[model samples]
Target: MQSAFEKSISPLGLSFRIWGITQLVFSTLVTALLMQVDVLPDITVVYYVPLISAFLGLPAWLILRIALGLLASSRLNVRSRLDRLRWVIVVLGCGYGLAAGLVLVVLWQQSVTGFLTGFALLNAAFFIGCITQHSVIMAYFHVKPHPTAEARPTPAAIHQEQNRTLKKSYMEQTNKVLYKAIITALLILLLLIPSVFIQNLVQERKSRQAEVVHEVSSRWAAGQTLSGFYLYLPYVVSGTTDSGKPYRIEKQLIVLPEEANVQSVMEPEVRPRSIYKVLLYKSRNVFRGQFRIAPQGDFNLSLVKWQDARLCLNISDIKGIEEKVLVKLQDQQYEMQPGTPETGFGNSGLSLPLASVAEVINGPVSFESVLRLKGSEQLHFLPLAGNSIFTISSPWPSPSFDGSYLPGTREVSDSGFQAKWSFSKANLPFNTYLSDTKFDAGKFGFGITMVQPADQYAKTERSVKYAILVIGLTFSLFFIMEQILKKPVHPVQYVLIGLALTIFYTLLLSISEFLFFDWAYLIAATATIVLITWYVRGHFKSFRTAALLGAVITMLYGFIFVLVRLEDTALLIGSIGLFLILGLAMYGSRKVNWYGNEQQQDQPRLASTE
Candidate 1:
């Protein structure tokens, strides 16, 4: 048998001159392939440009030459060197193939075919060159010398030498694996640099949508928030000044209702602006309350002018009030007009003077009004009475109950939604009557927003936030597959996968502008899954391996999509899901042998798709 110290050629020893000739031949083949495709219309691109790109490999060639030279001197033994050599060849082929695929996507419609043909040729050339180089290296495998060893083991010393070899091999394999894992982790972090831009893109798109909504809402009415039907009574008070002179001053007493209830029926409309849709609504509202006309304890009853009392209602957006507002007090009708009455409303509101003192002088009298208003986004009601109850119904299924309080009773489904709120003196933060103070009515109000369910941008943004999880788990999966198949996947391949994941967000954002968010998510996820699945299949040449990866990718995307749509329980569910993912990853890697510890490699063996 030949000694291990015998002279042999490594694939790495394929020399600068021979490699250049092979590269040129490959480039020429690529050019020829491009020439056959009809996509080349211009004479220069047809004849000259593609030929030039072949020679363009000189730069990459020189760089890879320096890298291989450095790797030749590494501490890795013969088997390790051979394994790494095969890995490099695999990467070379896959790198070109993936580049070809990406170019096919990014290329213009006009010249895509010819360009893709050239790239396909490049990929095939690399693949054939890699396989031929592997075969040559394997031909001299028995006689290949360890870079450090000076002599081959004699048959009598083989058993003793085997133990030493195993120890050394174990150390080499451990270091190699540890180093690769570290590089993969770092690559995961590096790939996140691009995901930052993806986040910015998501935000930029969301902001654009916001701008569209604002533009539409500017022409349409803004959100509506309704406050009290205040009973404003102006009285003349007779008081003595510091100089002891008698003076008469007009004093205002504000009285709130004992109980108030509002009923609103909202008809939602979606207004499209460019690529965005703004939610707007026309609401028919009825306000009913009962009031006690009792003045302040300090004030004389004779000074109170009940007839001149103005009943005012504060509407956050008066422009939204569509029609005439009519008030019915004690079964008498009174029309309200915009702007302040007597002691000015101090806000944008409507006011109406009582028909007569007889309307409320007897005792507590019930007051009613019908208001038809147009609004956008949301509607709110302030609890400005001792007891307040609000009932609102809409055909909109996705209503967000926002602000300080939630609806006590609510019904929501695909068909429609109805919500009712009840607030008593204990629940309200304000007093029933305003003696001489200004209260911010909006403070304790509760309302509902006509939220577009599963807002595409919002979901995309949430998905972007989980980029690390997607990329990290995917890289881990690929790494695990490498151990299982005993074939090393390159860092660049992992980067491409990360890039594909990031691109999925952009796809979702763009598509969801026209279609529903769920459909857009499904489409984007499918496209990305198909693409990555195809690329993975090209690498391993096994349908089962590619399908395994595709299934995992699908599950990851599906899980993220679910997390995005679940607003209320996202945090809890995400935490649980991540824990489970960690468990599954651990389970997947449980039996994976990091090093060929138990099994013996009689020779330096390298696996090949061929």
Candidate 2:
């Protein structure tokens, strides 16, 4: 006589292992396919796959029940017979119930009012009907075996009848148990597959997220570069040259690094040094000799918009010509007449001295002049010659300047002193100048501080809230539904509830795109609550219960909205909300009896004397 375990094990003989391996392989292949498929190409098909598959589980469950029935019949005689009849009833009832439930769901999806109400009502009705049918069938089977009859029989007859009945009854019960077990296992496994897949998918998504961050950082580092320019202008009219008629003199320079040994620098150095000769001519109309920066070539420049910039030159070797120089800026031209301060070139950007001195070849009088220009304005800088060397300038409709030019300052300092002077925007037409102009100025002299973008904080806040709201709402709805509905609600039901929750986020994003977040949340949350409340009321028997659930949902929405709005406290708010949900669920489920139907009433007992 072989043992039961040995017999069972012998029959499975590597088949179970093979099946497990095949399942893993198939699941992996499907995962890969799902990842590779472009959802945009066939979104409808992809979206419906899980939905269709959920309903498919019902049929799989039925088939497994049928197979279990056959298997039980060959072994347990009495239990098998009882089970077969039980399944006949259960299978038929469940089949009708499932069919009706699915139809109602479809109707609800297509039409919210009439069909949806009927649909939800139908599911509730079917659930009750199926349970009633099961109870009736079970009672009938138990009572049917023993019928009212009067019979006086011999010992042999009695014994034989008892044996037969006992065997039949035993087999019937065993078969029912086996069939139920198999059906349950099948349903559970079907649900389990998706859960497992989702877990793996979540892990993969996190990994991809990390990779994306790394990729972005790498790109930013690769694109980093450096470019800008400097200039200086200077001149002298020392009592005119001998053959001079009030002779005027001027010198301009495209300043470069004073050091000639340039090769001692790193290769691919974004910052380079260059110099240009001063192209100068002399005239009473100072503009005649001044070289136009032309807002071109490896340089950035800006001037007041809508106003002409008057280039004035008053080169005087003031205090420190050897070290630095001094230049006084006075308005030589006017825009709307110099009636008030605003009528003049006004204040804008920076104004400093452009000081230079004659540097005779191999002469000690040789001096390099540094011209500092500054202003605050919006402008654009683009690579000139379509290369790395950029030029900054303003477009049309910009400000213009007059009497704005400060004549070149000349100074002589033996020890060389750092020229310190005042530059004010008090001379510009408007208080607000283009940052573009300032940026160019920074490129030329002032170094720009690399910092976070202005909108980064707000954008990050929006994205975090958006993602959390969708994910939290989705999980919350399904979790609540599962809590309220004791019986096994299919994953399809969970998915639908989740979809409704996710739609809230979509609505929020759309409305917030046009309106404020507060208004958007109000509209979206109200709509979601109304629709879900109406559906849930129909799904359950009591409107009050549905309203209560709706209230909880609304509260959750408010909580999420708070999370979205309060940037500083979002984490704390979310954490507390999560805790509250968990505590409520824990407290609610404390009294639940897991072994039997919750709807079943408790048995009453009569008091007994001690």
In terms of TM-score, the best-performing candidate is 1
Candidate 1's C-alpha runs over 4 A off are: 1-173, 241-243, 247-250, 304-309, 329-331, 341-346, 353-366, 423-432, 565-593, 596-610
lDDT score of residue 433 within candidate 1: 64
What is the RMSD of candidate 2? 20.7
Where is model 2 more than 4 Å wrong at Cα? Answer: 1-492, 597-610
Q: For model 2, how does the per-residue alpha-carbon lDDT over 1-610 read when each residue is reduced to its tens digit?
A: 4334333432133222322332333333333334442223454554554454345434534553454435443544443445564455355435543553454345334232223222223233323333444433332223123465887887777667666765454544444335444333323222222322333344444355445534433432221111111223222323456777575443222322111110000111111112111111111100101122333232233221112222221121111111222222221211111111111111221222222111111111112223222111211111111112111112112222212232123122332211111222343222222212222321222111111112222432354334434444444443445444643445455445555655665565456545665777799889988887876676666687678778878887777667756668878877888888779867765664432333323432222322
For model 2, what is the C-alpha lDDT against the true structure?
Answer: 0.36
C-alpha TM-score for every candidate: 0.66, 0.35
What lDDT tens digits, residue by residue, belong to model 1 across residues 180-214? 88567656655554555566677778888888877
Best by lDDT: 1
Instruction: Give per-candidate clash totals.
Output: 0, 59
Q: Provide the lowest-lDDT 10-residue window in model 2.
A: 260-269
Compared with the true structure, model 2 gives a TM-score of: 0.35
